[model samples]
Target: MNALARPFSVAAEARLSSADLPKPETLIRIEDLTKVYDPKEGPVLDGISLAIGKGDIHGIIGRSGAGKSTLVRCLNGLVAPTSGRVLVSGREISSLSGAPLRAARRDISMIFQHFSLLSSRTAAGNVALPLEVAGVEKNEIRRRIPELLELVGLSAKVDAYPSELSGGQKQRIGIARALALNPQVLLSDEATSALDPETTEQILALLKDINRRLGLTIVLITHEMDVVRQIASHVTVLEHGKLVESGPTFDVLAFPKSQVARSFLSSIVAHDLPRQVSERLRPSPAPGSSPVLRIVFAGQAAHEPVLAALVEQFRIRPNILHGRIDYIDDKPLGVLTLVAAGGTPTLPGVLAYLSSLGLHGEIVGHVL
Candidate 1:
């Protein structure tokens, strides 16, 4: 079944209200940003407006060709926007050029998906290239290269060439090179998409450390949901080059308001019904059937005895179909699919029970 087919009224998982909008510690702000590749083809990025708070690991995700790359490139003035303003550290850079643009770009660093390292240069040599380009003193470059390489856990690989290094090590060299400029903002364009699962986790851990130790503002664009779920504090979704959804990663995952966002959450926040169960599923329960329900738990309710409470209060024992809990920003969020026999009459009350505890329970389909 399509995961986005059902909508749940979840006030607990709602986005931040406008009334409570205080002065946020914003480091990067894009206002009505639009990027058109071909005027005949329309805008690839359409009226995008979002904020990346200071020290935030902000993630932008979407399917391929959703304009994710264009959006991030615009942040650093790599792609000129067709219209709108981009402000980094409160300085508008959409129109700046020449030496001023170069000066501004030094504060914004980028780590590419493919480790953009020189095959001829060793890890330390690659890291020193940025400083050399900026014409820093040779003494300082020598002092800083080892420090930057050590920061990325590449102290031992300082003399290793890109061709000799593993994918993860090469990316680490790229990261070290990006950090050599000491930029406050770091942009990662699918940095982990090229790594294995275990290596991806390691790189993510290293990024989290960098964000913590250096208090860096990171903005990453990826097509992988796990990348955002693993590290991003805030997330934005793009659909056909339009801003479809944007919010805290947990809030967006827990309560997806758009079809594209809901589809993205299917594998992570929600599980699909098994084939046999789905084949038998009907809008109404059969004589000897059970009602299938999707129970969503987020925030504090994720730790509560939701299923046990339902059994006690409503006298309905749920036959678990599938369930999983995941941590986002160190908070527990979970979803469970279950079949409850002879419980349709009391479902409204059960849903109320779930809501009272900051959960949402929806009657999905009926099965025999």
Candidate 2:
């Protein structure tokens, strides 16, 4: 490791949008983006267009065939787009090559889920490899390696080889190496799917902290909605290689307007009753039993005790049949299934009150 390997910081130049006013949420632009692997299937991307904002923790979500990997590769020039243009810092990335291409690649960093660290190299050595490739001096590599390890909380194990490190440790090394150039944008390709849930949370915390502290625009590609809810401020849903939905994380979760978006939201929303549950444990409806309602809470609404307020205001007895809470981006995000004891007529009043507090309530079934 050499002195020339010290943290290399590069600022991304902003490109003014056609909006005329400062381009908001348009740091990187993809217009009519298309990729074709085979002539028979046609283009995989299918003319997708998107704008990623600066300092945005953007998420691209979809199942296996969504052309996610191909899209990210196109952004970095690793995969060529058959048609359309990718604008990085407002310039056409598709037009860059040679030294300019290398320079452009440096502005963006990508982390793979596989933790692609060198098996023969120690953690520090693995991180220092990038700097070495750029002809950084030995003394600087040593300084930067320690700094990188410290950034990822692996300073204590800097000398440990990849084989000796745990999966989490290996990923920490991968993250450190990705940040070697201090890129303005970080690309995470399912970086947490390979880890256990607890380890996933740890990595998520680190990623969120880095995004906030460095103001780095992060593009996370994953199939898991949990991963998006954990750290992304904004989300983009891709299905069949097309854009299905894109907006703030909470908004999409609250009112999913697309089938793809709804599918992604089911784990956190009051989805349609399962067939087994619908058929089993259902008792005959009795007079004065109560009406059941499912309420979804998130963002500011989760902070308010709306359900408690409803009980007090409507004088309606409430019984909780099912409840769940999910934390998204370190904020309270959850779903609740409950049976409220009251007449059918009073249900409207209680629901309206809950809605006034920025919460959503859906009646699932009547309770006796």
Candidate 3:
């Protein structure tokens, strides 16, 4: 589906209060942050609150016009919120002004999807621009430029112009530029959206490397679930302007509660049911029809022999429909869709057994 075609609502379902979020000194905290583009129409970001821990790769995902773009801009004072606070390194930046705001911004840096580098400048020149603007001496700029380029794996391409570099190399330059000030926080505003799948994976890997090596707090805003799955340690799901869900990446992907979260994970874990199965599916089981069930396994439960147990304990054989096993934070998270020969009659026992094993099973549809 086209992201712009999706529906949006300014009215948030349930607001997360500051008290409910993690309060760590080494984190960027957004408290009751709301941004109103047009006061009469309502806020584009509605009282969104979250905490990004130090050295964490936090992803914010939502469809287009979901306020992800505005949220990232707000982090560095490019777009100030109409109400609430954006605390960076324990200092409220929403109200900072002049030199204070400029100093605060030095601790925060951003990279773009478009690889916003000057075509006239070489990769080294672009990375040196930030340090130059800060009035760092030319000698120091020369020393730091090579180090930053090497960090992003673009040392050989330091003298290449933007026009001469590949998509991934240009993005590497962008990453190098964002790190010129040695910012504690790096905001990636859809940094991988324009690249091919392979290149995207490379950029994601580089970002992960930067986070681990430099202990940078990376906040990424994207609509791509695969991007989040590959790198983000934690994730926040947005709808319109409201935060629908926020939690550790594996936990959220394994068992998403909100409509937005379920939709994203569904694309990755559940996908579309087979045409043959879907064509015959109905809300209620018909005579001689089987019931389609979705089973979610995470943590220690993911290692269980669920299908074997189902056959042995309930005396029911499940025909596997669709399934996938994903690794998040090095832990196995699995999802399986199957059809049991018997319908609702055996569901209770099946659910009981799954519960005993700390797994989740839901009847999604019925098919012949």
Residue lDDT tens for model 1, 182-247: 898999999999999999999998998899899999999999888999989889999888999998
Each candidate structure's TM-score, on Cα atoms with residue i matched to residue i, is 0.90, 0.81, 0.89
Off by over 4 Å in 2: 1-25, 268-292, 303-305, 308-319, 339-342, 346-351, 363-368
Report how far off residue 112 is in candidate 1 (Å): 0.8
Top TM-score hit: 1
The collision pairs in model 1 are none
Worst 10 residues of 3 by lDDT: 8-17
Regions more than 4 Å wrong, model 1: 1-23, 284-289
lDDT of 3 at 107: 89
- The residue-by-residue lDDT of candidate 3 on 67-183, one tens digit each, is 999999889998989999999888888999889888898889999999999998999999999898889999999999999998888899888999999999999999999999999
TM-score of candidate 3 versus the correct structure, residues matched by position: 0.89
Q: Give lDDT tens digits, candidate 2, residues 1-368.
A: 35343212100111121245664657789999988899899778988998899988998999998998888888888888989999888767887888887888888889999988888888888998878877889998888888888999999998899899888988889999989988888999899989999999899889988998988899999999989988897898988889888887766776678988887877766544545444533354467566667788865567687767767887767776666676554445567776677646677887787788878887777755
- The collision pairs in model 2 are 1-138, 1-142, 2-137, 2-138, 2-139, 2-140, 2-141, 3-139, 3-140
Q: Rank the candidates by lDDT, best first.
A: 1, 3, 2
Worst 10 residues of 2 by lDDT: 6-15
